[model samples]
Target: MSGLNSQRGVGLVEVLVAVLLLSVAVLGFSALQMRAITATDESLVRTRSLTLVRNLAEVMRAYPEAYVTGSGATFTTVLPTIASAVPTVQAIATSIAIAEADSGDSVTIDGLIISINGANNCLSTGTTTDDDDNEIPNKLCSINQLAARDTLLVKKTALEEDIKLAVVSCPADATQQAIQQQMCIITAWNDTKALIDDTDTKACANSDGVYKIGSHCLISEAY
Candidate 1:
């Protein structure tokens, strides 16, 4: 009987040990799963930001005359408000509310033009001459800029909850001719704002325009 009792105690100890090991394994797996989820979210947002940046860049290239003024020789400063770039300006437009009527439903929101700096519409009456001295309407001359503006506004309105955009000049100061041609299209999501054209210690980008550690932002240099 004594031998039997000793055997039973040993069995109980072994069972407790197994349970403890199992609990630790389960906890480790949970931690790994959480980390994977966080990483996936980060990657998804970065991809979306890249897409938005590329789209805007292409649009700007298409609208070569859009940013130029004064006989189409000088570049117009698009971003008049420097301070508004860092903390993103909140733009308001007609709101569209969509409710899920059933599974596999489709929703479309019509474009509501948002004016920047109280600028006139592209279709407004204005004309400029091309290199060949061909008379061009303002709509044709600045179509690229208009397209870019429309794209930014529409994307902002649709993805307002997911992302923020600031179309700022690259050098911020635009002092030099080489740097004056570049523009910075910054897209940020979830607690990350790209560094403005300044040397702020807490900003995402450094003086060299490189992304710093722990800054959640994607900066694209557009010509």
Candidate 2:
């Protein structure tokens, strides 16, 4: 009887150990599931934020001149002002800030900023004094021109690829014609020097010729 009791006690102890082990495993699995859920939520938020930022960028790019000329109030009115523009602009100013603030995982709210300084160009500078005794410089026109060209080229290339793919997949489709026309226009605008000439002489010489889309000389006296 004593030996039997000792064996029974040992069996109970073993069973209790097994139950404890099983409980730990279940808890671990629950923790993992929670972590996965959290990660997925974070990813979704980040994607939404990125989409919002892109929309904001498009708005600014659409009206590049307006962005340069408009006041803070104008910007707020043009863009969705649910979040202030100043904070959004600050995040874009620095790479680190962009990385840190852009993540949807961050508890802090994210924002978009469009900063356009008419006085300072993205390229090089020329020194001058304004009415307020503030020294100013004209930004390098060449760099801006090149950047614009590059942007257009990238867009054109992507559009051409899509058109080619569509045409291949549907040979007789009328959509191909529109894409083809667009491609031709892009090519003409990019390749024609008369269209993008910034110098006064070129502008004067090409006054009667076909100019590029948004050519400063053709569109406005200030550009």
The 0-to-1 C-alpha lDDT of every candidate, in the order given, reads: 0.51, 0.30
Q: Weakest 10 consecutive residues, lDDT, candidate 2?
A: 162-171
lDDT (tens digit, per residue) of candidate 2 on 99-215:
222221111111222112222223444677789989887544332232222232233332332211000112122232211111111112121221223454333123333353433
Best by TM-score: 1
Residue 62, model 2: Cα distance from true site in angstroms: 1.1
Give me candidate 1's TM-score against the actual structure: 0.58
Over 25-110, each residue of candidate 1 has an lDDT whose tens digit, in order, gives 99999999999999999998888888777766665565443322221111233332343221111111112221221211111111
TM-score of each: 0.58, 0.30
Identify the runs in model 2 with alpha carbons over 4 angstroms from their true place: 1-10, 68-223
